[model samples]
Target: MLDLRSFLEVCKKEGELLELRDVDWDVELGTLTELLAEKGGPALLFDKFKDYPEGFRVATDMYTTVKRFALAIDMPPDTNGLEIIKKWRAVDFEPVKPVEVATGPVMENVDEGEDVNLLKFPVPRFHERDGGRYMGTGVAIIIRDPDEGWVNVGVQRVMLHDERTLGLYISPGKHNAIIREKYWSKGESCPVVMDFGPTPLLFLSAASHVAWGISEMEWAGYLAKEPLEVIAGKVTGLPVPANSEIAIEGEYLPPDVESRKEGPLGEWTGYYGGGERSEPVVHVKAVYHRDNPILAGTPPIKPPNYAFAVQVRTTPLLWNELEKAGIRGIRGVWEHGAGGGRMLTIISLKQEYGGHAMRAALTAAGSHAAGYMSKLVIVVDEDIDPTNTNEVLWAVVSRANFEDSVSIIKGCWGTRLDPALPPEKREKGDLTHSVMIINACRPFYWKDRFPPVNRASEELRKKVIEKWVNEIPLLRG
Candidate 1:
């Protein structure tokens, strides 16, 4: 079984963490995170919150760096994307059946009915323009299938509407949304438990988009190289981590399905869409927490944050999975910085023929999240590094012939998050939209000889850095 205590200890040792005492969620936590992310910083923990009872607390900025992500998965501190990909590819996950205990820290403090106050905790006002305090950015909401006895753990952002109410955004097609629909179909309420504080491996497992019929908690156990000790939920009849700091047990009923305005908050796309939309409202039935409970914080915003680290970890793994499916000569693959891991993917490949790159691009693009709005897939030559915008643009500028390189396919698929598509198309039916796969590689058949370039050896580059380190003012002490 996974021990969250041990995992957090490892994070501290790996130089990926920070602990702050007596912090507030409204302005202090958000301000600290913004400042820390700018400096390539560590995770922050709020030991004491402003309005919350003395036992209430919070932590934020987890997985802010690649080094931190490596540490989270028990990899070496210096591990890069390639190394992470190699390790993940070699590993196959086995399901872990949870061990139950009589009771644990989560039950230390319980608040029910009118006494249950969400505002008592450090639910942060993340963006300046956010309408309400968010308590679920880093939390995992647990639900069980009525027929299968299978448990689903997913990372869904929840907005704190009041002391006993929550605004949950479970878009259609998500596992939780599907489960909720099942309950609604039967004219019954869906039971759910939301875990606020969790171990890094468990958090990652919950965040991952795994295959159907797979239990996320079991996947987490495999990732941790151990079985996750999960206990049955008191309210939801679901399995939950024994060491979870806070567990808010609740239900979603058709009667409680009130339409409230959500969002206009900064999305990962770095764009702000206007107004509130109708979504399911959650009514809290019970609240559980450990002694001196610690709250977890995550800013659901644009790049250069914890979200960026998750995308960075995902890119190489996704590339590895695609290659394993038989596509070859994949020189480089990049999930574009602005897209936030959805809209665009850039690939560099060795083309066998005219449409070789296009074929590979199509396969890779559809590898995951294919039905999203306007999936832009661009393919370049081996000389280009897709991660580097400058290098990618250079290939497009020097080699890409607009007439030969560009191709567009209309009426593909789209998602609810895509602002360009109509709201109705996002929620129902296939999101038919135009898609493009641009071949930016040089036309090899026409060129007589390849261009030569001067490059430095790894050893020589290291030596040069060492030699000039003292002479370089930035490098000098």
Candidate 2:
């Protein structure tokens, strides 16, 4: 419901935002962000860099908490992850096309030709081992399909190459990469517009796995229940969010025409998984920004701490996919942040018949949402909460049979970011990996005879807590 600036104001009002002055951009700012995110700290608004002018700022950890994420999508700040998921799933996905405007705040300051300089802002190096300063960690790279004429706004890591150039790296098989390749096949540079500070909903849409041909901008608008304002880029003629902080109009040259080394930067997988490699470069033609631009940063740090505090969007997609595949009795679905969200998934379901858990496990292993880069899929009984790692592990150890409960799905969809992917396979461009599905439910045949959990019944526990909560203050929680 709110734009980027207004969203920050809301966060500030909720005491979820912190403004830091004069932090070093090279590593200090990034290190601070990492530490804060690991501790579930507030969103950081960094200003007054050593070499950059004041008001030229970088904001990080904006969605590193469920409340912040909920606020971003116009939900009540107190909404939990599952509630957010259910709310999202209830939405109708009809595209709400962005309305084009002649000009807006982003046009307040413009730089083109020789005047375009990217270093005016404080671009963080993010990691000690990073190859270069990155400006697109929390960016939306807009490109259109040449043949279909459909637009796509997707998130990809961008490394600053020079004053008027950027190194772009889209993961293999992604919609953006697919569309770019279509242009390359025609021997033409792909027109591009990079939005450094898109609205939170737009950023979420860019980072999501929206189906091909469906514009992310429209999807974002549909989610917001309104149309986003857009302006055509002066050079690329591509749509840019009129209210965004900074935008770069450019073209991604075909790899054969122009390329540069990218990555060795820290990834969400907690590893420099892609390493340094040659990638296509975007030759910036025009740059536009508001008077005091705010660049959003979502640089990936180690596991258990991701760009988003919770993987809110994808979990629902996975759940819907499971349901669509006819897997019933699914009580909960959770993608763990420890494995960069996608590598490990837990599903809790009510076991109705023999092999029901196994069926759900196999289906989840290949489902559209959980199919990629997935390492493990664990199926647990309804008694176990999928979000509680300890409870899920207890179910696995207590109920699973090694010979029958475990099954490996080899050569499933994966990515180069998989740290466990062998060097040999990576070199050969074999990005596929395996997934292990563990059915952790009690044996269906004799579930009635299986050992019962020692925990008290829910009715007794609730009644006792309600009766003695004031006396035993700890029970109040």
lDDT (Cα, tens digit) per residue for candidate 2, span 367-451 = 6666778899999999899999999999999999879888998998888888899999999999999999998999899889999
Which residues of candidate 2, in runs, are more than 4 Å off?
A: 307-310, 459-477
The candidate that wins on lDDT is 2
TM-score, predicted candidate 1 vs. hidden true structure: 0.85
TM-score of each: 0.85, 0.95
Task: At residue 54, give the lDDT of candidate 2.
Answer: 83
Q: Cα-based RMSD of the predictions, in order? A: 4.2, 2.0
